[model samples]
Target chain A: MRAHAQLIFWAVLVAALALLPPVVGVLHEPFYVELVRRVMIFAIAAASLNLILGYGGLVSFGHAAYLGIGGYAVGILSFYGMNSGWLQWPVAIGASALVALAIGAVSIRASGMYFIMITLAFTQMLYYLGISIEEFGGDDGMRIKTRSQFSGLIDLADPVASYYLVLVLMFGTIYLVHRIARSRFGMVLRAAKSNEARSRAIGFSPYSYRLCAFTIAGALCGLAGALLANHTAYITPDFMHWTRSGEIMFMVILGGVASSAGPLLGALVLLVFETLLAGWTEHWQVILGPLLVLSVIFFRTGLAGIIPGAGDE
Target chain B: MPPLTLVFEQLLNGVQFGVMLFLMAAGLTLVFGIMNFVNLAHGSFYMIGAYLTLAAVQWSGNYIAGVVLGLAGTLLVGMLVEVVALRTLYARDHLDHVLATFGLILFFNELVAIIWGRTLLDFPRPEWLRGHVEIFAGSRYPFYRAVVILVGLAVGAGLWYVVTRTRLGMLIRAGASNRTMIAALGVNVRLLYTVVFGFGCALAGLAGLMAGPIYAVLPGMGEMILIQVFVVIVIGGLGSIRGAFVGALLVGIVDTLGRAFLRPLLATMISPTAADSAGPALASMLIYLLMALVLAVRPEGLFPSRGR
Candidate 1:
């Protein structure tokens, strides 16, 4: 039954995507393609967060800082006339990883609110730094004149091509996370989340495993940030703001933590709600706030948590 | 031009800023320490306080009345939030608290924007407190700012007295130390929590009310101070009242002085252009850098919870 469900899920996903473009073409409404692309981008970020929050039991309030780092990587490099994919991608990932490692080292030692506060402070530091960089446009932000070039393979300047590229990366990330979750390393992570003392008794340092998970999550979110900069063709200090981090965490909760595909569903619900509600009224957040409160009250498992056969193994 | 006068002026500014931060941080620490709830929406209460103060001042035709109404309004809202949303989250994890409070932040910001409009509101200092008073032979400070410092010090003393000398304060301290034990003692834990929450809200509201005249009464003003408040609580030592007071003063002084003096100091050492470039950026981060240093040396904070 599980196998059948998986097969059906994959089939539906493929069929929907394959038919979506043509359907939109028939209707002469292709804007949703861009929306779907956005959903995918946010999903990548949410999923990365899930790896730490859900499996590793680390709730970081500052995950969006990595997204900012990733975006800044692209923006700063491009500003300096180094727009090659090889140079840009590695530098972005490396910078994000270094930050994650340093922050995670000190932060992982503190549990609960202390950890949350530390992460928040570090992220705010980044936000202020971003604002202070007068050359990078400070609070105003920097506009990318052109997207990264990938030596004759990917033309990121083309919207459709960039959308497909993001989609591919999204799929690749999902697959990688899935494999890691099912592996021995993932077993220790889950164990640590469930019972740190027991995991310690088993001779696994929970801190190291958690740190590894956090770094990996940061790297993935950074990649999403890079894609996001490409998507908007602009990067701002707002990307790294604490509020952005809150929004991503909202996505994680709305989708149901610990469940695969939860973040994607949550991102879709939030973005679509945001778009539709904003269209209806300028005070869309008022509606959203109460709705979110109700959702948390009623659906502890989130939107994905309600679906049949959606529980995590 | 005298160093003594310069130092005195900076000290006064530091104390004023510190008191404001204490108003914000005190509530945050109390809620977290007593209830074990990590409320990201505490800042929203501060925002509400500012907005309410603005409205109250307009309606009452007096700034003092506005201040009272603002405090009362925030207390009411805080209690309502506790009874409605936060009570359910008590049994849940910190993640739930973080997310729900985040939702509240979004909700409150939008609600304020809807009611007050997007443009920033001017919270006028009362005519009585508008002028400056001379503190030293040559230096003068705003009378309103002096009032803020005095009020903050008074509140801090009152808070200290209540926490240390009163029955409710004993209950709060006890609750923080051990909720289960306190619950077992037949105290109405829920009611206690609500009262504590309301008290914290009132403190935040007071901060907001006082801040209105000094800072722009805007939709997201609370957000700017929220992180700084967090840093103060962290440095003071989570769940420690004495820590919050000391921490607030430390952070406020360091931040204000850093911004005021770092550029000049750097200019004296380095080239003017370099100092000009690096000064503001470094000034902005000085408090956070101090926090990181504090956390590094003392992971639990300057004054951690006793026993565990």
Candidate 2:
């Protein structure tokens, strides 16, 4: 009965999201359209993170680097007079994948906290690099003067068109992630996460599997980055800031990190909370900080865990 | 501007920076080594110490009295936090420790901002340590910096003695090597952890007080230095004081030298304009690049402690 309800709950959520823009339009609340766009962009990033953090059990504290790399890929390419989404998006994904491969190759050699710190160090290095490039606006960052041209099939300048594009991409990502999570490869990844020694005993090398997962997640996040750049029509080094990475991690933990749907839930809740609290007062962090502490202490399974009749499994 | 004099002065600067890093890294290594805990909020003590010193100096009209009170205050705060918040996280995973402590960081940052405004706090050096010393061929070094180096070294030596030459040191070592055996031997493990934590907090506080005059004391100041300190510990080897000391000096020297000379060196290879833009950027990245290199070559660090 609970499983049936869980399925129904998810289906209703997707239907509601698909109908959000029209409903908001009827209510004359275009602001919510923009808000939901931000949520979906982060949802893609958070879902990618869950692949490594939740299932693979790699606590990559620097996952936001992909966001920056993806953004920069679009920003830099457009600056160099390439605005076609076909070329720009692939390069963004490719660049992030390459960097991920490099970071993962070195970082996977170490285990536990060491891995976390190394990943952080690498991301900080990238953040510094982003600020150092004078042509790319240096510390101030650059504005994307024009959105990536989608070859006239879809006009990115139109808010409605861009909104639908993000929505479709988010659904595609959710489907792809769900399939990956339940596949044979995901089983091996989870096995390694739970018992590396035993997995190695069973003749599976954890390194290649982990490195593969890390790269794929980075690629997925890079796609999200491309969409984010288009949505905001601006990219900054701040996208890869350490705190941004922390926020992404918090989203994964908040949503429950159990399934693909959890990150989407987390992203929406976080943005809504931020929006509501910021409206109330500027000193929202003072409250949010303690709330995070309380959650970590009490909500081990996170927001998804609170669902009625949801078993431990 | 003479090359030799410049090199000598930069070396002194590097040593001074390294000594300061040693102060922060020592406490960090101790906590990690003995308790098997990753305390991200260790920097909070540093920030609090600086703030307390600033307040006490303004109130008491005596620098020495202010420094003493500042250290004591931070020590107490550190202990109180350990008892109140961190005690529950002792057996939790590092992720839990990270989240809880990160939350503490945000809380402390906002609280400080609310109390003391977001502006920088200026701390003037005492008159005795104000002038410069002509130590090299017509090159003058600040007396305040010289004193900072001396104090850091003195504290480093003191920590070495306490860790290696005392009974408490033995228990600490034993605890790091085998917590179960020490607990079974009826050692007051709980008291020891608290004491060790307090001592580490004092060390961080001392570093903060010393840094107050050299750098602006502001909210989140601890975080600025915390990353470099982590690099020191990683390069030196976590859980090893000697490694931290060596790593700190190496980092300090390399960082100073890179900032001073990397641009010019790059200029020789590339155009001056290209070098100018790339110099500061590369200089900023030098330490992280060094850390990556070290990890690639020696994953366990240069001085892994016994059994870890």
Candidate 3:
């Protein structure tokens, strides 16, 4: 009975989202599509974060570094006059994966607060480096004159097309994360998160599992960054800022960590709230601050847990 | 060139910067130590302090009065944040603390933007601190800088005295050691936590007020210094007051000197063009390298708490 209810909820959610474009068309609202696209991008970022933070229990305060690297991959390649999708995407993902490996090599040795600080420091180093690079426009950021072309396979210049592409990626990522979470490797990672010593006792090397998870998460976030750079046709140091990383964590928590769909829901809710509240008042954060505090204080289970079918899963 | 004057000036700057960092790290380490809370919003208090000082100075037309009022204002806000927001987080996990404080940072940054326009506000040093003082032959340093150094020293001495020499200090230390025992002794742990939080905020505010004339007063100013303070606390060992003091000094000196001399030093070893390109990048990373080295050698930091 619970499984059936869960199935029904997911079907309803998908149907509702599919019907959104037409509903907005009826209301003469053109910005709704863009908002959805933005939400999808953040959802991807949040999902990547969830792999390490929610599942692996690695509170990396520097996830934005991957995003920045990914974005810069696209930005720098384009600046050097490379506009091929195949080349840019691979380079972006590869660069971010490499960075994750380097940072994770040293940082994964430390647990808890030390891990958090080390991640933060490494990301800040990247942030400052980005700012010091005069060729990349330094603090001002660089403008991508055009999106990466995929040789007639993908036309990213069209917003609707781009939006659909992002949605597909987001869906694929969600499905992939769900599958990974149920796998043997995922079991090891989860065990490590719950108790490292016990996992070690059980003959699992927690470090390698975590590093792999962290690397994979970084690669995924890097993909999101590439998409984001294309979406905006620009990249800046702000892309990798620690605060941006914090926001991704916020989305994960708001939606309920350790759940497949939570990050997506959290991203949507947060983006919508930000848009609505900003429209209503200049001091939207005043409202957000207390709301967040209350959420942490009272709603430890998060919004996903409030859903009748999703609670305690 | 007189070596004594150069050494003296650098030492003074190092001490001053160190003290400011200590003020920032003290609050952070205490919160982390006592409540096991990772409050990233601590920097926001420093930013608020600077903003409040700007407002008060403009309103009251007295810099000294503005500083005092700013400190009080930030303290109030800090206590209110602890009671209204951070209080509930004590029972929660570290992830929750990170999320809540992150939200607070975003909220505060936006609030400051709305209250004060995004443009940088000009903070004028008062007339009394505008002159230069000759500390040695052929060298003159800004009196304001000296004042800052003196103020930092005075505050450090005061903090040491309060923490080591008073009943409240004993309570604070005791709270860090064992919160349940302190509470079991019939002490109001809640009030103590609030006071400690408030006191930490005031120290951040004091740093901000002092920094107003030295640095640009703008939105998101807290961010630049926030990570440095984290490094200080980490190097000093989390939750140790002496650790914070020494770590702050070490970081300040390393960072300041690295920025000032790295390029020149590198030029001798590498090509000038390479040195020019790598100088700032490497300078920025010096403290982080120091942190990693410290972690590698002494993971508990130089002056970590004696026991778990």
Candidate 4:
């Protein structure tokens, strides 16, 4: 019964998010529409990270690399005068998938802290590469002259349309992730996460499962990245920095690791805190830093843990 | 103008950079080896050291006094942090340690920015250390760099002696090799952790002081160098000082030499424009490439500690 209430609570929250832009429009808070859009984009990113980080128990410190790759896909394509969303979005997803596959191939061989450092190094490599691409505006980054042209099917140029598109995609991603997590493959991944030896003894090789998850996560985040570039109409190497990865990781942990929908809550809370806190003080991280520390030290289950019996299992 | 002279001078520069890395990596490795704790905020200590040194220098009107006070301050601060924040994290998972320390890093970066402002602080080379010295074949080496290398080597030698000879060093090695065994022997492991952490902070501070004259003393400086330090520790072999020394020197030389020479070499082979972009890009990636190669060949590092 409590589980049903928790589920209803989550449904209500997601519904409120869906209704947010209209509500904000009524309040003349156009700024919040942009903020909510940003939150939804990152919600996709964080949820993608959850597949590998929370479910697979792989702490990939270079997840931001996918964001950069995806964003750059759109940015670079648009720079070359191609703005077709159909073309750019898939390219972003494909490029990120390939990179994730390659990085995962090597990184998966190493476990524990080595895996963390290796993933970070790979992202730094990409970051430096981004800076060296003089043709693409290099370290300064590039502005999108126009949003990804959808050939007038939906007109992404319309803010309301773009907002609803992002909102819908985010909902789809969360639903898809929930289904995957309950599937047989996700169970194997979870099994691998808890005890690799036991899983191996049972003849389910965790390696391929993990690699598949990593690739999917990367592709999803890449999609988010493409949206992000359109949403902001700019892309920079700064997007791929390891600290951004840290922020995403913080969202996963802050909301509740290994729990479906936790990353959404995490993303929502973090974005709200950042926006509200930064408005008050330039040294907002001074407050944020301690909050993260205190949370880790005290609330091992994250924000979701606050829900009675939610992550108690 | 002579290629030989350029190589010779750049080699010395590499060694200087290597020495600086060793100071940072040694402390990092020692803490990791002895405590099995990952401290992402180690770089924050490096930043603190540099800022404190700069502040002290400005206040005291004397470089030597500033160095002394800064080192002392960093040591004290490191111990205080360990006692206050890190001790609670000892029993937690590695992820928890990473998250908490990362938080510490954010806190320190913000605090420093608030206190000192975000702009880079000017750290001028002292008068006696400003000029270049004539070396092999009349090649010129900066006096400051040469001094840095000398001091680094001296410290490395001292660390070697202490680790291989002293009772405290013996305890540290023992702790790394087997923590429970040492605790079983009734050693005050907690106090030892504090001492080791403090010593590591001092070494990081020393590196910061040396680095201040070369790089801007500013917020987030520690983070910039911390990646390289992590590379050093990983390449060297966690919990092994010898590994850190070799790894630091190798990374230092390779990085400097690659940046200095790779572009020119590439230009000779490929088209100038191709070389122009590819050279610096590849050069920047050299250390990470080297690390990848090492990990691929030996995941435990070049010299992982024994009997873990």
Q: Give RMSD to native, each candidate.
A: 1.6, 1.9, 2.3, 1.7
Task: Please report, as a residue range, the 10-residue window in candidate 3 chain A with the lowest summed lDDT.
Answer: A304-313
lDDT at residue B39 of model 2 (Cα atoms):
78
Ten-residue segment with the worst summed lDDT in candidate 2 chain A?
A304-313
Instruction: Look at candidate 1 and tell me the lDDT of residue A275.
Output: 87
User: Between which residue pairs do clashes occur in model 1?
Assistant: none
> Candidate 1: misplaced stretches above 4 Å?
B1-4
Clashes of 4: 0
Interface RMSD of each: 1.1, 1.2, 1.8, 1.2
For every model in order, what is the number of clashing pairs?
0, 0, 0, 0
Query: lDDT (0-100) at residue A114 of candidate 4?
Result: 68
Give the CA lDDT, 0 to 100, for residue B264 in model 3.
79
DockQ preference between candidates 2 and 4, better one: 4
Q: Which TM-score value belongs to model 2?
A: 0.96
Decide which is better by lDDT, 1 or 4. Answer: 4
Residue A90 in candidate 2 has what lDDT? 97
Q: What is the TM-score of chain B in candidate 2?
A: 0.97
- Please report the TM-score between candidate 1 and the true structure: 0.97
Worst 10 residues of 1 chain A by lDDT: A304-313
**Candidate 2 Cα outliers beyond 4 Å, as residue runs:** A308-313
Docking class of 4: medium
